[model samples]
Target: MSLDVGAVSSSKNMGGFDESKEGAEKSGVQEVGDEKQGNVKRNMSDASMYATEDEEEDEEGNKIELGPQYTLKEQLEKDKDDESLRRWKEQLLGSVDISNVGETLEPEVKIISLSILSPDRSDIVLPIPENGKPKGLWFTLKEGCRYSLRFSFQVSNNIVSGLKYTNTVWKTGVKVDSTKEMIGTFSPQQEPYTHEMPEETTPSGFFARGSYSAKSKFLDDDNKCYLEINYTFDIRKDWAAT
Candidate 1:
C-alpha cells in the first residue's frame, strides 16, 4: 500500500484557509459587538439626562426653583398662615373651637402674711399665723378692744392689666358692709403692699359671738373674678379670752 503525500499537503492548506476565514469572521463579530455596546451606553446617557430634566418639571411642565430671596419674616408668616389654615380645617372637620382648646390666663393674688396690733402700736402675731392652715383667717376678735388688721399680699404677673379687690365680711352667712372695694394696678415689686383695717371701720362690734369670715375677690377689667381669698376668725365677749 502507497500513501499520497500530495493529497495530504492539499488537506493541510485547506485547513489553514478555513482557520483564517474563521478568524476573519470572528474579527467582524467583535467589531459589531463593540458598536452595539457603544449604542447602549449612548442610550443610557440620554435616558439619564431626560430623567434629570423631568425631575425639575411640575405636572404642568413648569420648572421648579427655590427662591433665593426668601426672608425669615416671610417664612415665618407663611408658617403661621399654614398653621392657621390647618387649625381651621381641623375645626371644620371636628366642629370644635380651636381658641378655647388650651389653658387660659388666670391671675393669682394671695395673702402672704397677716397680723394684729394693739393700741400701744406693737405687732402681735395671730394665734394661727397666716398661711398656717389650708384655708381660713385664723384670728380672735374682741368686743370692746380696738385692733388693726394688717396684711401683706403678693400679685402674680398673670394679671396683664389692673385688678379690683372687693373685701366683704360675712356674719352668719349674711354679707356685711365693712370695707370698700379697692382698685389698683400691680407691678412686680420686691416689697409687698401693706393694708391696715382699723377697728372702727371693721366688722368687730357688728359681729356677735360667733364664727365670721372675711373674703376678698380679685376682678379683672371684664368684671370676671379670677382670684379669691378667705379668712375665718372667731369673736369673743371678753378681751381677756382673745
Candidate 2:
C-alpha cells in the first residue's frame, strides 16, 4: 500500500464573499411554513421541500478526516533513518532563521579537500558523533558512541553526497522529551500502527536529532568552504572508564 506523504495545510472560508448584499432579500423572503424570513435556505431530504436552517446532517454516513498525519518526532525519526532525509534535514537546519540572534557557534570549517580528477569531486571529512558535537571540531568524544559519516560531497545547482551511519543499539536511538523516554525498542514498520488515534496524538518516534551538509565548488588553490555539524548527546558514564 502506498503511504500518504506531505504536510497537512489547509484553510477554511473564514470571511464571506466580497460582494455586499447589505439589505438584499433577492430570493423569496421566506420559506412557506417558516417564521424566520429569508434567513437561510437548506435542502430537505423529502420532495421539493426547503428548510430554513443550515443542513446539519447528524447521520449523513461517516465522514473521515485525515490530519496531522505525521508527527515532528515521526518526521525526525524517518529523517534519521533515511540517508536522503538526513541530508534534507541538515540542509533545512542550515537554512534555519539566522538573523538578529547572537551567534551560537562560530561558523568555521574543519576539513576541505578537492578531488584529483575533476577538482570538483571534493571530499570533506565530516563526522557527527553520538555523544559530542555532531558538527564542528575540537569537541571531545565519549565512549559507547554512535555516529553518521558523510563520505563525499559535490556541489551544483543542488548538492549531491554519499552517507552512512549506525544505529545506537545500546544507547537508544529512541530519544524523547525529558518527561517521556524510550522504554523499549520499536520498529515502526514491523506492526500495524493504531487504526484510530485521537487528534494531535504525539507520534512515538526517534530523537537525538543530528544533521550534516557539505558542498563543493571548484576554486583557485586556496578556496575552501568550512564544514561543521551540531548535535546533543549524553556521554555513557561507565563506558568512559573502559
Give the number of the best model, judged by TM-score.
1
lDDT of 2 at 32: 17
lDDT of 2 by residue, 78-152 (tens): 548689867655443333333321132112122222111112223223343434344442222222232212222
Regions more than 4 Å wrong, model 2: 1-51, 57-62, 65-71, 87-242
lDDT of 1 by residue, 1-242 (tens): 11111100011100010111000111100111121101011112333223321132121242223223222222223446587755533332233222332122443556566577657345656543343332554555565555655555554433222333445455555443222222343322234545554343123354356766665454534444555556676666654332
**Top lDDT model:** 1
lDDT of 1 at 25: 10
RMSD of 2: 28.3
Model 1 TM-score relative to the real fold: 0.40
